[model samples]
Target: MKVGLIGFGKAGKAVANVILQSNEYSLEWVLRQSTILEHRHVPEFLGIDSKEPGLIFSTSSIEIEELLSKHPVDIIIDFSSSNGIYSYGKAAASRKIIIISAISHYDEDEKQFLSELSSKTIVFWSPNISLGVNYLMFAAKLLKKIAPWVDIEIIEEHFKGKPGVSGTAIKLAKELDLEETEISSIRAGGIVSKHEIIFGFPYQTVRLIHEAISREAFGNGVLFVADNLADKKEGFYTFEDLLSPYFTN
Candidate 1:
């Protein structure tokens, strides 16, 4: 698949490396703010070797559109900020390009815009793109079916710099039909990410945990979803939707 990427931050860098290393996808274009391009280690930060070819970088939507006109891509994976999404999503949707966004923390207006955009093109949006976290969500749903009366709580831990509750925790709580307050967030050290779902009964408790050893796990998950989405029909989708096949088996 020919792929375009937006953002060159940590997660974006990871995703870029995965695409570069993969034989199935080609990294055709990257979009980032002009400020990010000022970094001295642009190629190194994007995991692109000096000898690599066919990768275009741009800071404007018009440039991205021009590139798409010259070289159409099968999918566009976005790891940009919420503002970036707001800026670029419409352009991609107008061309009926598939978008896979890993951005979180959207305001009401942004959410509404994305919702409307999905009708015009396939949009897979999720805050937590890790396969393990998505599987955890699946497991939480099963646990709810097996023990509906059990009280459930989500505990998530991330690096101190991470803001708000983990998106995986919020998804888990949503899977179990619980409120955000039922999820606890812990910020410490440089932990990549960790989440635990606890099921409490009168005399016994059960816990399901997933911990990321590295960011590559998330990169792999993102690629997996992109591959699965190749045949999906247009609409807004999520990581949970990707778990449908597993649920049947």
Candidate 2:
């Protein structure tokens, strides 16, 4: 499988590591800004070089677009910010390329971008791409059905270097119809990411939690999606869509 990555941040680098290690996929190109090198030594830290097979770097969407036009890719994974995502997403979707995005916020153009490609291509867009979170989402749905009246709250923690609160927790909150502001966010030491959905009522309380001990946990999910995406028929999808049908009793 040929794959391209957008953004070279913590999560992006983590996913790139997994893609490089996986025998089933190849890293075609990484779309990032030229000044990204001046901002931080990403390539040195990550040991990425353009000389490597299928490895290329681009500073603009036009550069990436030209690269893709010359060499079609099976999948393009966007782990970028809202602004960055829109630039690449438009081009990827235009070519009907399967896109797996882990961006947090969305815009009207971004929404319409996905809408246009929803039927002809497969696009997986979610705040948290972790498998554990998706499983947690599945569990939450069951809990909501079984214990409809349980008061639920979410708390999340992330690295201080991170920009904001846990997008995953916020996403889960949205999924369960909980107020986004009710989902708490914490920034501390070297913690990668952690989230807990707590349910409490009169006498007892239940908690569903998934903690990421390492960034690699996220990489696992991205790799899994990349592997499965190659064979997807075509359509907009979610992590739940990839998991085999399972029920809670």
Please name the candidate that would achieve the greatest lDDT relative to the true structure: 1
Clashes of each: 0, 0
State the lDDT at 161 in candidate 2: 76
lDDT of 1 by residue, 1-249 (tens): 788888877778777777777778777766677554532443465656743343546564346667678767878888888877776677789888888888866677877888898999989888878888888878888889988999888899998989877767776787799999988899999898899999998899999999988877867887899888888887888887888987798
- How many Å off is the CA of 56 in candidate 1? 5.7
Q: After superposition, how far is residue 236 of candidate 1 from its true place, in Å?
A: 1.3
The number of the candidate with the highest TM-score is 1
lDDT for each of the candidates? 0.79, 0.76
Candidate 2 per-residue lDDT, tens place, 52-143, comes to 25444656434667878876787888877776755666677678788888886677787777767777678887778888878888888789
- How accurate locally is residue 117 in candidate 2, as Cα lDDT from 0 to 100? 72
The residue-level lDDT of candidate 2 at 150 comes to: 82
Q: What is the TM-score of each candidate against the true structure?
A: 0.89, 0.86
